[model samples]
Target: MSEHAPVEPGQVLPATELVRDRIARRWEGLNERVQAKVQSISGLDRTPEVRLIQQASSAGTVTKRVSWLRKAADHVHAGAAHLAACRKGCAHCCHIAVTISRAEAQVIARETGAKLNPKAGVFSMADSEDFGEAFKQATSGAVGKPCTFLTEGSCSIYAHRPLECRLLLNLDDDDLLCQLVEGSATNVPYLDARQHHVASVAILGQHQDYDDIRNWFPQGRANDTPSTQHKAD
Candidate 1:
């Protein structure tokens, strides 16, 4: 028997419940499709981690899966190296709003021993009115600030950077479009990031949120704090 039955012409419909159920079903369907696409990609046969993503159900497992997917996307981006204008020492695009999965953030924190500030006013796209609004809200205080991992105009965590950073490949001839202080460029090229993005989001669900890359590190490093000195002679 169906949980919901046909309603009469003048009957009060369970509109809110129906809408919520419909949205949930749609999300599940989309997640299934995204997983299928990731599984079908060539050269993933050699990647054991890709296979493990199917069995992932926990937060830690999902993070590992996302990390593997980011690496695979990096490989694909490298294959199209000729179409990209991005190079070392060109860090203009690093100033933009970059959304990342909770899993990715946790991985970065673990790797770098950085503390995460949950009250940094980061907003999730899932809760925003739209992508543009989400970007605006999440990056409110982070626009001109360089990424925390950027050192001397290069990414210090290049090997383990987030998926968003790995997939961004500027197609513009120069950095003019990326040099803009507000809004992203339209001509930037990127690998097909849909699979990884959707898969990670589906796995992370509401737990995922955006945070500025700069906020991940502790305010003061272990060496930055003043050490106690013995009484002077």
Candidate 2:
């Protein structure tokens, strides 16, 4: 089959199906790994800080969730070393729109000592007739506004970043494709369509709605207090 050939309705592509299956299996193991990690941390140390870590890990705090996601991403990356191009200091893809659940946002807020504003930076492209143009407009202002957590070209809250950020793994060889100004297309392998659903379930034990990452924290600055007015794009 041609690499660019379209699959007909009701047809299943072998490669696509295999990727989906692999992601599904990895997602299924997240809970087990979380438990194992928590147990190891709890048993290997007996300090007060370690005890606090154990408690938080068992309760599925952002720290534990981040650890689980890192492990899961690493497992998937290990199998696709030839396809993955994500690396530290490569912040090209960070300019795009990022949405996250309320739970995840609250965690970030707590960790960063920032106020959580539910309505800030809200936007929806569901009604757009021209998706590309709509996306461009929606993200135009954010092109240079690196994620609030980004400092010195690195994610300051890397471990506690949103699930949307966690799932972005580029499968193309050209890093330029990740640039906001670049029009080139890039491959995305090992992507599970149900990733958001799984993330919501794992984080909040059910489906949770999302908002833009920029909206979660207060405007004016990363650690600023939230305002009463809502900001939308």
The runs of at least 3 residues in candidate 2 whose Cα sits more than 4 Å from the true structure, single-residue gaps closed, are 1-82, 121-144, 182-207, 218-233
State the C-alpha lDDT per candidate.
0.52, 0.47
Model 2: pairs clashing at backbone N, Cα or C within 3 Å: 120-215
lDDT tens string, model 1, 60-170?
A: 565566655665555555544444545545665566556665667777767655566666535675775665676665666554566655555556566567767776765
Best by TM-score: 1
List TM-scores for all candidates, in order: 0.60, 0.50
User: Model 1, which residues run further than 4 Å from truth?
Assistant: 1-60, 128-134, 181-192, 218-233
